[model samples]
Target: MSREKGKEFAEQDLTPMTGAATDVAPLGRQQKPAHELTADEDIDVADWDRVAAMAEFKQLVLAKRKFILPATIFFVVYYFALPALVGYAPGLMSKRVFGVVNVAYLFALSQFFMAWLIAALYVRAANRFDGMAQRIISKLKGGR
Candidate 1:
């Protein structure tokens, strides 16, 4: 298309399908300019530093580390155990279960379930972590 036509298209008012004039901003909702955005207005660095240094924060971090490190180690071991077993003992892995279905296939399939269970557990733990974090924020804000 021509530059003028393109410019016209760009400048065209996008009316709703109902053909009624709406209060919505043209082209879409108006957004605040980056410089005008005050997303960090309530965040005090000193308060954040103080909260980070608190024993509560340290406990929170340690708690997360304790859970996550062990969980990660467990998952890694569990995930790799299948391959190691298959490689080391192909005869055992090849053994039939119900008709043609083998042990290896069942074990591989179980990995999917294991991953989903881990994710669910992580979500539950994360909810607790969120509560801890909120408490820390509240303490910093002098609300607790």
Candidate 2:
């Protein structure tokens, strides 16, 4: 093909396809640079000022608070409820299904597993919460 034809073809190929547009995050969506924060380190005020000005940053802060409250409530309820149920309702819950292992016995034993599972879940969730909190704080404080 002629150079002119090639150029025209390239231009045509570059045209946006109907309903096929890909989502592209702007450059700002990328991760912020790392910073070593210490108790005595001086903070950069400009970054915080910029972040505080953003609506998305405010939403993130609010969302974190929203999740934390419910997570705390759930943790309290499940933590207390499981133990209490196991202790008080053992007879009611008792049922032999696997040899001599009763439902109550299983429920009591399962609490240990439940504790570990809850801990693991909380650790993962809290880590994410910590990240958002730190990000919001850093943005407010002007840290990278």
- Most accurate candidate by lDDT: 1
Assess each prediction's global lDDT (C-alpha) against the native. Answer: 0.72, 0.58
lDDT of 2 at 11: 34
The reply for model 2, stretches above 4 Å from the true place, is 1-61, 79-91
> Evaluated with TM-score, which candidate comes out highest?
1
lDDT of 2 by residue, 66-142 (tens): 76677778767866876687688776667786998877777667668876876787677768777776676544344
Q: Which residues of candidate 1, in runs, are more than 4 Å off?
A: 1-44, 47-49
lDDT, candidate 1, 1-144, per-residue tens = 122332333343322133235533345445433333367742222334455678989989998998899889989999999999999999999999989999999999999999999999999998999999878766645533
Of candidate 2, the 10-residue stretch with the lowest lDDT total is 1-10
TM-score to native of every candidate shown = 0.65, 0.44
The lDDT, on a scale of 0 to 1, for candidate 2 is 0.58
**lDDT against true structure, model 1:** 0.72
